[model samples]
Target: MLVLVGLLFPLLGCGGPKEIIVKGKVTYDGQPVDNGQIIFIPKGEGKVSAGPITNGEFNFAAPPGEMEVKITATKELAKAAKDGLPNYVSYIPKKYNDETSLTATVEDKAENTINFDLEK
Candidate 1:
């Protein structure tokens, strides 16, 4: 019975899912950005996940480790501007057509909170 109990202890010590909490805010012109998508691209891996934006804030959990990530924010609210015309209706530049990108690193057993300020 003692041997069996010792074996059970090792099983209980097994590691569970390792996760890292990532949180951040997005702002443009000093204003909270809403309805934008934040993408995380892991180093050497094509896996990606879209983080949702709520009230200019976002949070996500990823496997605990060092990771190279790129964040982006899209201008969804400014789609339709004056005269019911799309903001990028004509002469849209490649950079302005999508979200702005930033590169950052996530450390192990750490909570990373970052803020991205986009330009108009």
Candidate 2:
């Protein structure tokens, strides 16, 4: 029984899923994006991760594998008001979000820099 207990100890203390750090920049029409959110959804079965875009940059830890990327940006809240209603508009095209055409491969111990240059 003592030997059995020792073998089970390692299994019981096993950690959870593996993850890696990812970072990149967002540019629109040749200039850095102002504000937005970036999301990474694993191609297979895995948890999704997100990061906030600030000054055209974003970074976060995510699972290591193939992931579909989605980006969304809009004008400032004060600048988006129209007809007394919040008219949040995205500067990025739908092909980069709902119909994302962006993909990235994340690996361990490597510089994971994924940059996107969008057009208006």
**lDDT for each residue of candidate 2 in 1-120, tens digit (9 for 90 to 100):** 999999999999777887788898999889888889999999989999999998999989998999999999887466546577776777788988999899888887655888888875
- The TM-scores, one per candidate, come to 0.57, 0.83
TM-score of 1: 0.57
> Model 1, poorest ten-residue lDDT window?
88-97
- Residue ranges of candidate 1 with Cα displaced over 4 Å: 1-17, 64-101
lDDT of each: 0.61, 0.87
Q: How much does candidate 2 score in TM-score?
A: 0.83
**Clashing pairs for predicted structure model 2, backbone only:** none
For model 2, the local distance difference test gives 0.87
